[model samples]
Target: MADSAPEVPAEERQEDPDVVDRKAEVLAEQIKKSKHFIVFTGAGISTSAGIPDFRGTEGVWTLMAQGRQRPSAVNTLQAVPTATHMALVELQNRGILKYLVSQNCDALHRKSGILPDRISELHGNNNREYYFRAVASYEKTVHDHRTGRKCVRCGGDLLDSIVNFGEYLPAEPLRLARNHAKKTDLCLVLGSSLTVPPASGIPETVGTRKAAKLVICNLQETPLDGLVDQRIYSKADELMTRVMAKLDIPIPQFILRRRLIVQMETTGGSRHQLKICGVDVDGTPMTFLRSIKLDQYCRRAACIEPFTISFRSDLDIGTELKLELEFMGNYGEPNLEIIYSYTGEAGTEMMYLLEYNPQTGEWKTERQESQSVDEDKKPTRRGR
Candidate 1:
């Protein structure tokens, strides 16, 4: 269905370095002077992260049109945020970027530390699923919007959040994006071909305003290139790196952070069961952990949800339990060890925060005790 969309010539272009530098300086000035600055992004911004774009030379649509094999790409779950993604995060941290609108479902922008409230992912996120009454992440692989899981509240079927061909866009994200576009005085377009309507038209709206300025940075010519105030035929990462330097803002490095909630339940007598799983900041089930091992009990739970292990042992009030966690290894992260001490309580819960820096090959861990253990409690669902 994606191949049926409109196509542009697969011609890539790069502007001279000197010209790009000069334009970056001017863009930096515009960012500083503008009151309401916003950004619109597309799949091109993720190409550097091993994700292929739609209209590029080796893009999915381009390959389909040329009768060539589809280009192989890194799994969206394994890919890390690119330089451009991190740069945008830094910009938002400084309050220079008011809002962000993106057509990408890769979830890089959200993983790059951007707040969910500050961005509108118009196309929807691959990692998210929607029920009629709520939206959350699904544990199993979802196909054609069917997650094979029932809604906890209404007993309804859960659906994938991805917007397919002929499907109407989600209303809330579209409303927020249009509102931001109407109020934006400086709109920065990155990695977009400006071909897809609705999502593409948001940037054009800002460009049409008398007091607004629009700048586009992409490797291919966009339909709105001639009308834009500044057009740089360059990679999003390259141009954003220059712009950050001109603005004297340091681009932050990417750090992978995960939270794990561990709970222990007494089956009977000396028998006990321990459960462990990864969770997001907002308590959504995050399936980054591939396997878990309890070395003391010689038990392992891998390739399955509800990672629990049952064992019998005489435990003291302050017994230490060691767990070896094997992650997905997308960023070459090594297996981590978690040392949790038991409180000798039937429903005791412990939280662990793990941070990994791929650049330095370093890891940090923090442990906190939770007061409540509600197994039936569901994460607060959010609407896009």
Candidate 2:
């Protein structure tokens, strides 16, 4: 009789088998033809869901491994579901989903409404406690083994179902996830940065095993970004909303828009034309007519008007005006008055009548312009 089990020599096993398997082709074709699919999600996905994911120096896992306790799950539940979670739920409800595997211990997947049976909680839930045991299919024994008795299975200390740093993956879920990878026609990965082991290896395993067409969706760039067949850069919530629409699911529509405006004012001096040069709220000069006048004498009467001014060509604010005035009677120096008006928004206008005393060689304001509700009339008094 031939040896009951023919053993291949170790030398023969060294030869590489055909790397190109028809299974990969078949899986790809099946994906094009069929609808059933498996999805493996990562921490990156939950970030949009408002639940923190871990694994990097900044990741939730990293913090926990560093002796920091994870936040309570109650807060996560109160937080709103992200577009990514809604999309996953839509995929499951439409029956396009075969199963979902998540490494998160936050239990957010369940809270998002995916059926427990359809999801493989790879890392287990943080809320309830249990310990890993068994071989081919690891068994989880409840934390409160029983008030009536102790842990009968292993009699070892029961622990939380959550897998931690330095802990190996629970066997059963890992096995199921592998089986799903080998058989799946389409594998959609969402939000995971795909850095950590065992889980990160899933995409490569599926590719190597001739399993499925891989689609990886994430925000920041990842190592597997170039390796996947399809890549999307977006928040989970928005991405899922689009996916749901494609599947004929009714989703609410929302968008954001904005507008702004600004205004300014400045004073101008001699030899310079007052020009509005800065950008306006709408990028155009304010609509208003401008008027300018020069070389006018205002010593005779209230000869100035609002939006109007008078200046001496040779003298500025303080220049001596020498004049010999022989008063026939005892009287003081003449008083000068100037009047000005402006009709525009935010009503503000003023006028000043001044005199240059040759005796003191100083300029003194004799009168100031004032505002009135009615149109101003010229002053009847004369100048000095």
The number of the candidate with the highest TM-score is 1
- Tens digit per residue, CA lDDT, model 2, 1-384: 112111321111111112112223333344446555888887666665456655433455555555667665426424444566656676677676788888776755664566656877776665333333322233443323222211222233434456655567877778888878778767877767676678777766665544456776565566776666666655455555555544556642111100111111123333211111111122221111122222234333212111222332333332322211211111123332222222222223233323334334343543233343121442221111
Best by lDDT: 1
**For candidate 1, lDDT tens digit of each residue in 1-384?**
456644565579999999999999999999999899999999999999999998788888877877778857999877989999999999999999999999999989988888878999988898766566344355443235766664433446766678765767888999999999899899999999888878988998988888899999989888887668999988999999999999999999999888898888899999988788677677766667778988777644545666787767767878888898988887888999999787888887899999999888888999996666765886555221
Query: Candidate 2: lDDT of 200?
Result: 71
Show model 2 residue runs off by greater than 4 Å: 1-33, 55-74, 131-158, 209-211, 251-384
RMSD of each: 4.1, 30.9
Q: Report residue 352 deviation for candidate 2 (angstroms).
A: 89
Off by over 4 Å in 1: 1-10, 131-143, 147-158, 265-273, 298-303, 310-315, 344-348, 373-377, 380-384
